[model samples]
Target: MEYPDPKRKSNMFGKLLMAAAVTALCIIMLKHSPSFSTPTHFSRHEKGVTHVLVTGGAGYIGSHAALRLLKESYRVTIVDNLSRGNIGAVKVLQDLFPEPGRLQFIYADLGDPDAVDKIFSENAFDAVIHFAAVAYVGESTTDPLKYYHNITSNTLMVLKSMAAHGVGTLIYSSTCATYGEPEKMPITEETPQVPINPYGKAKKMAEDMILDFSKNSDMAIMILRYFNVIGSDPEGRLGEAPRPELREQGRISGACFDAARGIIPGIKVKGTDYKTHDGTCIRDYIDVTDLVDAHVKALQHAKPQNVGIYNVGTGKGRSVKEFVEACKKATGVDIKVEYLPRRPGDYAEVFSDPTKIRRELNWTARFTDLQESLGIAWRWQKAHHNGYSSS
Candidate 1:
C-alpha cells in the first residue's frame, strides 16, 4: 500500500515458491518410503487371482471364512481392529499361508474413515465379505449404542469405501435374530424382520442400507441370515475363542466347554420355559463348516446389480435341553446345568427354511447332526483349554 513495495512483494513470492517446493518434495518422499509403499507380493489386478477383502477376519467366523478362502486359492486381505477378534487366529493364517500374495492382515478399524479409505485406495479388491460386528444379544441389550455404532455405522463406512473403489460384489453376514420371534416356525427370506434386541436391530439396519444402496448401484450383494452357529473348522485349524469377560454373554457351547474344563463351576441355562418341545428355547444349530460353505457359494453365485437374501441353517430346530444333552455326550462330562430365568430379547424358537439357498445356491448343511457338531468343537476346546491365548 505504501507506494507499491516491489522488493517486499518479490521476497513474499520467493518464500511461497519455496514452501510449495518443499511440500511437493515431501509428497514424493512419502510415496517412495518403505513404510508408505504398496505391498509388492500381490497386485489387486493380478492375473487369475481374485483379491477379496475379509473384514473382521481375525474373529471366529471371519477367521474360518478366511481359511476357506485361502484354501480355495483366493487372495485375501484381512482387516480387523481386534476388538473382539483374536490376533492368534491371524497369526495362524499367516503361518499357514506364508507364501506371498496369499494372505495379509491389517490391524485397522472400519470406523476410521481415513484408514478405510486408504485400504480401498491401495488395494483393488474384487469383492468384500463384511463380517465385522458385535454379535452378543445380551450384551447388545445393555450397550445398544455400541452395537449400533459397530454394526450399522461401521457397515455404512465399509459400503462407502466399496462404492468409491468400484468394488462390485459384497457378501454380508446377517443373522436370523432379525426375525424376532416370528409367529412362524421356519423363517424364510420374505419373512418380516421385526428385531427384538439391539444386536438384531443393528444388523437389520445394516441390511436395509445395503439393500437400498444396491437398488441404485451395480453392486452384487448376498446377505446370509444364519441361525445359531456352532462347531469349529472341522480340521481344527480355527475355533471360537471369545474373551473370558464375555463368557456370560458368549455362546452356549462356550459355556458348556468352560464348565467341562472346570474354568466355570457350571453352565447357567437361561430361559427354561419358552413354550418349546421342552422347557428350553429352540434354535437351529448350524455347523461353522457348513456356514462358511454357504458364504463361498454366495460369493460364487453373486451377480452384478442383484441382491440375494437367504437363511443359512439346518432347517430343523433343537431344544436347549437337547443341545445340553448332546454337549454332555460330546464332552463326556456331567456339565451341571442350573436353570435360570429368561434372558432379555430371546426368541422362543427360530430356525431357517433354507429352501431358497438349497435351490438357488445348491448348498445344504452336510453336518446336520448336533451331537457330531458339538463333538467336533469339543475336540478343539479340549486341545486348547485356554483357547487361542495358549496357542
Candidate 2:
C-alpha cells in the first residue's frame, strides 16, 4: 500500500478536467453545425489509388462524379468528346489535384470505336463510370435514330472495348424516364418498364444490353436510374453549366434559372391538370452532390459476379408549383409562371421507393430541400450568368 503524492493527484485532476472541457466544446460545436445527409462514417476505401475511367467526364454529372472519386483519393482519367461537354469544368477538376498522374484528361469520343479501343489499350482501368449519351428528350423525339445510335450503338462499342481490356466493373448513368408513366406512385425496380419517349427508349435499350452482357460475361454493373438532379458542389467548386443551346431544353431547375436571369421571359408549368394536389406533375429532385455519393457507393460495392439496379432518389415527390415557389424564395424574385397544357411524354407523378439503396448502400439525400437546392443552383447561375462561357 502506497500513499498518493499531492503533486501527482493534482496533475491527474487537471488532465481529467482538461479532457472534459474539450469534449464539452466539441459537443457544443456539433450541436450548432449545419446538418447534411451523411453516410455511415468509415473509410471509403482501403489504402491505394483506384484508377477510374469517367466517360463524358466534362459534363455536369460526370464531372461531379469524377470530383467525388478524386476526393476519395482515386486516380481519375476523364475522356470527353467536347461536342457537348465543358472544357472549363475539366480545368476545375485538374486544378483540384494538380499533382501529375493523379487526374488526366483525354479528348476522345467513345462513338469512334478506334478511339474507344485506344483508350483501353493505353490505360489499365480498375473501373469505368459511363455517362456518355444523348439526353435531350425533345431532340430525341425529332431524331430518334440519333438517340438509338448514340445510346445503343456507341454503348456496344464501349462495352466491347471494356471486355477486350478486362475491365469488369461499370456504373451506368440511367434515368427514371426509363419507367415512363407508371401507375404506381413510388416506383420500384420491379416496376414494368414502359418508356414512352425516344430518349427513354434509347436508355432502356442500353440497359438491356448491359444486363445481357452481365449474364454472359463475369461483369458487374450498377445501373442507377435517377430522378431529376439539381444543385451544385456545396463548396462552389463545381455545378451544372450546360452549353447555351441546351439551356431551354434543360431540366426544370435550369429552366427556372433562365427565367430568373431574363434569358427566358418566364418558366413554363408544363402541366396543370394532373390528379396531384397542385394539379401538376410531381418529381424527385435529388441534389447532384448526393447523387454522386450513390455512384461512389455503387463503385465500392460492385463485383464481377454482381449485377444490380437501384433507383437513386429521395423517395419524396415535389410538385412543379412547389419547385417554382421554391425558386422564388431562393432567388428572391417572383418567378413568372406560364401555365401550359401537359407536354407530350410527361408523367403525372413519379418518384422512387429508394429503400434498396438506403438499406444496401447506406446513402441519403441530405440536400433534398427544394429551396436549398434551388438556392445552390441560383448561386452558380448568378456567378456564371453565361455559364462556363462567362469564365
The reply for model 2, stretches above 4 Å from the true place, is 1-47
Clashing residue pairs, backbone N/CA/C < 3 A, model 2: none
What is the C-alpha lDDT profile of model 2 across 3-35, one tens digit per residue?
A: 989999999999999999999998887654433
lDDT of 1 by residue, 100-178 (tens): 8899888999999999998888787999999998899999999999999999999999999999989999999999989
Please estimate how well model 2 matches the true structure, expressed as its whole-model Cα lDDT: 0.86
TM-score of decoy 2: 0.86
Decoy 1 TM-score against native: 0.93
Q: What is the lDDT of candidate 1?
A: 0.93
Among the numbered candidates, top TM-score falls to 1
